[model samples]
Target chain A: MILTVTLNAALDITYHVPRLQPHTTHRVGEVVERPGGKGLNVARVLAALGHDTVATGLVGGRTGEALRAHLAAAAPGVVDALVPVGGETRRTIAVVDGESGDATMFNEPGPTVSAQEWAHFQDAYRELLIDAHVVALCGSLPPGLPVGSYAELVRTARSAGVHVLLDTSGEPLRRGIAARPDVIKPNAEELARLTGLTEPLRAAHEARRRGAYAVVASNGPQGLLAVTDEGTWRAAPPARFEGNPTGAGDAAVAGLLSALVEGLPWPERLARAAALSAATVLAPAAGEFDGAAYERLLPQIDTLP
Target chain B: MILTVTLNAALDITYHVPRLQPHTTHRVGEVVERPGGKGLNVARVLAALGHDTVATGLVGGRTGEALRAHLAAAAPGVVDALVPVGGETRRTIAVVDGESGDATMFNEPGPTVSAQEWAHFQDAYRELLIDAHVVALCGSLPPGLPVGSYAELVRTARSAGVHVLLDTSGEPLRRGIAARPDVIKPNAEELARLTGLTEPLRAAHEARRRGAYAVVASNGPQGLLAVTDEGTWRAAPPARFEGNPTGAGDAAVAGLLSALVEGLPWPERLARAAALSAATVLAPAAGEFDGAAYERLLPQIDTLP
Candidate 1:
């Protein structure tokens, strides 16, 4: 089983407006809602790709109930092990303008996890890890949890003999990498922030040297660059797909994990990650990839050493 | 007892952001949620002013549950007679810019109400009206409900010998006015839309001639103008108070209804309404009046024939 943890899960709502004007009233059309957070997004894609996935996190209040209900109805394949907490789960709204096709996002700071809840989550994480082959610690820590929350999870996964993938930014990411997780997936900007290098190859190398076993840097339309102990490779799609790029990184993480579990070579794993990431851009909704696009793009992806 | 009907109730969410920019992500600060609709706002104000207020309307799903929970916790003074339905209630978000102090609003189109649910609501409305002295039909009709929903409610209240106040806009307001409710409150724009007269006094008179027993026009900053069978009056505050005008009209409606229940004369009713409306503007949150300001401004309000 593949386990994914989202410390701060959200009920993602998308409001479609004809045109967005600042400080004016808008009658929104088509309100679309889904369960969201980086780990959950990755778990969703993995489930869609025919992998056994379990999701764990802290959720509370009515908003938390709503998120759980959505997950049960929409992603039945992914198992729910989310624990209850005190505060209401926060909501993230994307106001998508129909005219300009631009989305203005407003993210509410998530519910604060109590000290008791954090201790309880650590116990639950260990229990879930008992049956898992791989685990992905994803997204930011909700307030009240220590900044080393992801680092703690990484250590737990390592002790359980599970290959953990750390996907987060800022202090959590900085601290988590020191635990020497199997893989760290950071986009180009995040890579620059961590390693202070503009070039992707050098940045990934620097990140690995800082204790990440492998570094997978997503370069938006350009695709994935990987620096692993086995080898270094660059994977690029034949064409750039134009659509919403909201959950492309999560798709890449799912692809990399799936390929790793299948015991594929480094080149094949990089190719799969690049194809899934690009296909996700073509898909209309977040956390979903176009299967047909993925199939076509996969065979044509150029992986160079 | 005063009964307020919110046919389309909402979970009003306010997000405070440092600044609002088009197509950019905002980390929102201070998320505030309240149960809202025009009638609900009036009911809250009436309860705050020590009146026995009952709020009735359609609510459903998880969002409805959240709204009810909030109403229970916050407005314990107001009685809850909200009827349950199958569809989820909607949410309206106000993104307030901290820098400019301007709010950008986004309203979700409420859940589609089945005909069976509409029939159930009418039954509930009639049952509640039996012990009520006054009923205020407020706000827009949700999808799948008849356009003349308010008209039906007006007739039901009138048949129960209950004084009815119609507070809505466009076609619902037009159809509701024909039911000959005891009072109809319209802002300057709503009055113009109803009577095709730009002038407030003329529009108020025209609206009364159409079917309302009395017409109260809320003129922003300038205050209240009333055209009734017994008399015509204009009520204005000593000075214009600057703040949010979101629920000013609802405060005016609450003041008028409270005064009517007390058997106050038309001039006194207009004065109370104007003072409450101005105080509401000075209050930080919607549907709340600054008590100190209301008391100071009430004695200074100038009412002229």
Candidate 2:
């Protein structure tokens, strides 16, 4: 089973309105809600693609219950082993102005994790890691959690023989990479912050040398760039997608993790990851890919090494 | 006992932010949540002022649970006799940008009530009306509900010997007035829309002639105008209050209801309503009337007949 951890899971609400005028009233025409966070995003895709996935994270209060209910109904295959906490789960509102087709996001800070909650998460994670072939530690650390939280997760997963993948930014990513996760996936900006290099390939190489076995970096429309012991590769989709690109990154992580579990070659893995990500951009819900879109774009992907 | 019905109640979420910019993510500084809707807002103030207020309406799902929890914790004196439905309660977001001191509101459409749910609400409303001295039917009717829903509610309350006060707009208010609710409060725009008269006093008289026992019109900073069977009166606060006026109307309803139960004269009722409405503007939360501000402004109010 593949384990995905979202330390700061959210109840994502999308409000559709005709237009969004700042400091004015907007009567939303439609409201769509779902469970969200980087790890949950990845787990959702993996489950949709028929991967055996378990999603574990901190969840509390009524918002947490709503998130759990949504996840169950939306992604039935993904087992929820969430750790209970004291504080309420956070919510992210994306007000989509239908006229402009632009989204304005208001993010609520996730619940403060008490010391006891953190300890509970550690024990729960260790138990989950024992049955996992691969584990993906994803998203921001909630308040009251140390900056090295992901690093601790990575080290623990590795100690239990679970191949750990770290996908985050800032101190958590920096510290997690130092713990030598099997894989580290960063977008162009996050990669630059990690290695201080503007060029994707060069930055991925620097990132790999910093302790990760393989470094995969996303360059927006340019697609995936990777550096590993096996070889270096670049993968691009057939065409560009100009829709909501909110969860495309997480879809790429799911593709990479899924391919790794299946023992696919590096080039094939990149092609799959790139195709899934491009397909996700065409989907209405953030981080979800259309199956037909992915299948159609799979062979058309340009995989060069 | 004062019974207030919020047909379309909400979980009001207030987000305090440094600044509000379109199409950007805002990290909220603080979050204050309360159970809201016009009737709930009225019930809150009545309870604060030591009135035996019973609040009833439709609520369901996890969001509904959160609303109940908040109401229990914040307004313990206000009895929650709310009806349970199948759909989750809606939420309204008020983003207060600290820099400009302006609020941007995003109101979610409340749950769609099935016929069964509407019937349940009717049963609950009838039970509460039995012991009520006054009943307030407030706010808009949610979708899937007929436009004449409030008219039925008004007629039912009148038949039960409960004095009904209505505060709404558009087709709902127009139909509700035909049932002759004891009092109908409309702001300038609503009054104009109802009577098709640009003049407030003229429209108030026209509204009363159309079967309403009394017509109370709010003319923004000018305070309230009343045309009742007793007499016509104008009540103004000591001075203009330039602040959030989202729930000032609800506060006025609370004030009017409170004085009416005490058998106060029209002049005194109008004075209390105007003072409470003005004090609401000075308070942080929409419906909360500032005790100090209300006390300070009470003696200075200009009440004329």
Candidate 3:
């Protein structure tokens, strides 16, 4: 079982408009709503790829209810989310122009989680991690939560003999890496912010020295770079494609966690992660990956040091 | 008794931010949620002013539930909204910059009202208008409904011996006036759009000549103009004050309906409407009129031919 923790969940709403002109009225052509947040996105992709996953987070208000309902309707058996009370879940509105494929996003500041809500979430997470083979901490912390919240959670999961993966940015990532999670996934920008290094290889190495067993840095179309205890390796997809790249990082996290749970070798995990991420960019909507595309690209993905 | 109908009601969400920069993330300082839609706004102001009013509209999904909860919590015993199945009510996000008093509004396309939902709403509106002295058909029509939807509604209320006030725009206003509603309130822009006359007096006169008993055209800080069978007049507020002007038009409609329900003279009704509209602009948030400010301005409002 894979347990993914999304501390700040969101009700992601995508509105298809012909075009977006700021400060003007627009008539949306279509609206699609889904449950969102980094951890939830990774969990959803894993579930869609035939992995059993449980998503836990603090959810409140009507937006939270809508998020849970959307998740249930999307993947009933594979996805289970625990909702906590206090503030309404935040919402992210993406105004996508179907013709141009450009998107303008307006994100609402999600509800602030009270002290009691964080305690409740931690308790639920501890219980869920008991049976989990792999645990992933994803996304930003809600307000009122200590910056070291992810670090504390990672340490707890490790104590329970669970393989933990940390994927975040800024201070949380810096603090969580110090606790030495088994794996950390950071995009190039976040990697730079964390290690103060522009070169991908140097930054990955710096991250590994800080206690991460493996540091995977995604460089968009340039593919994935992993610095592990074994050695540094680069994996690239067989071809480049164009589509919505919003959730590609989450797809990579899902791929890595799924392979780790299945006991795949480091090289195989890196290849699979790159393949899944490339396939995700080909999907029409955000956070959705094409399983058939992943299958087609798997054998051709190139992993090189 | 006043009954207000909002065919496309909304969960109005206002996010207070210091300033708005396109494509950048902002941490909102405050968030306020209210039950909105022109008719709903009108009803809220009427209830605050001590009028007996009922607000009916088409509501669905979780957003609809939240709208009802907000109305119930804010102005208890004043809201009686009828819910219809099929589509969730829409949400309007107002990104307000407090310093500049400017708001960037993103209005969601409201729920598509199926034929069944429209039938249900019509039945509810008829029942609510039975004992009502004035029936206000306000705001835009939901998708899938004809442009003359408000016209049909106004005719229905008039047939039941209820004085109908139509407040909408474009085709709805153009057709609704032909139904000979007792009163029609269109802002300067809407009036120009309806009559193709940029001159306010000419627009109001043309609207009244087109079967409407009276035409009330609100001209923002310039105040209001009215052309009635009895006479034609313009009313200006004593002073111009700066605040959110989002719902001032709806507040004017509420003031007009309040005086009409009390059998006040047309000039008095027009004066109250202008005063309340300005008072609404003085309120910190949209859809609320400051009672003290309204009272202060009422006595000083000037009416001219």
Q: How would you order the candidates by DockQ, starting with the best?
A: 1, 2, 3
Model 2 clash pairs are none
In candidate 2, residue A168 scores what lDDT? 92
On TM-score, the stronger of 1 and 2 is 1
What is the C-alpha lDDT profile of model 3 across B1-305, one tens digit per residue?
Answer: 88998889999988777766654556666778998889888988899989998999888888888888888887775767666768888888777776776666677888888887788888888888878999888999888788989888988998999999999988988999999999998889989988899998888888888989998888889898888989888999877777878789998999899999888998899999998999889987677888899999999999887
Worst ten in a row by lDDT for model 3 chain B: B20-29
What is candidate 3's CA lDDT for residue A26?
A: 65
Comparing 1 with 2 on lDDT, the higher-scoring candidate is 1
After superposition on all C-alphas, the RMSD of every candidate to the true structure, in Å, is 1.0, 1.2, 1.8
Q: Which model scores highest in DockQ?
A: 1
Candidate 1's docking class is: high
Q: Stretches of candidate 3 above 4 Å error?
A: A97-100, B24-29, B97-101
lDDT of 3 by residue, A1-305 (tens): 99999888889988777765655666666778998999888888888878889988788888888888888888675567666687878888777766667676667778887777777788888888888999999998877789999999999999999999999999999999999999999999999989999998999999999989899999998899989888888999977788878899999999999998899988899999999998899987678898899999989899998
Evaluate residue A87 in candidate 1 and report its C-alpha lDDT on the 0 to 100 scale.
96
> Compared with the true structure, what per-residue lDDT tens digits does model 1 show for residues B1-305?
99999989999999999999999999987899999889889998899999999999989889999999999888999999999989889999999899998889999999899999999889989899999999998999888998888888889888899999999999999999999999999999999999999998888988988899999998899888989999899999999787988899999999999999999999999999999999999997776889999999999999999
Query: Global lDDT for candidate 3?
Result: 0.86
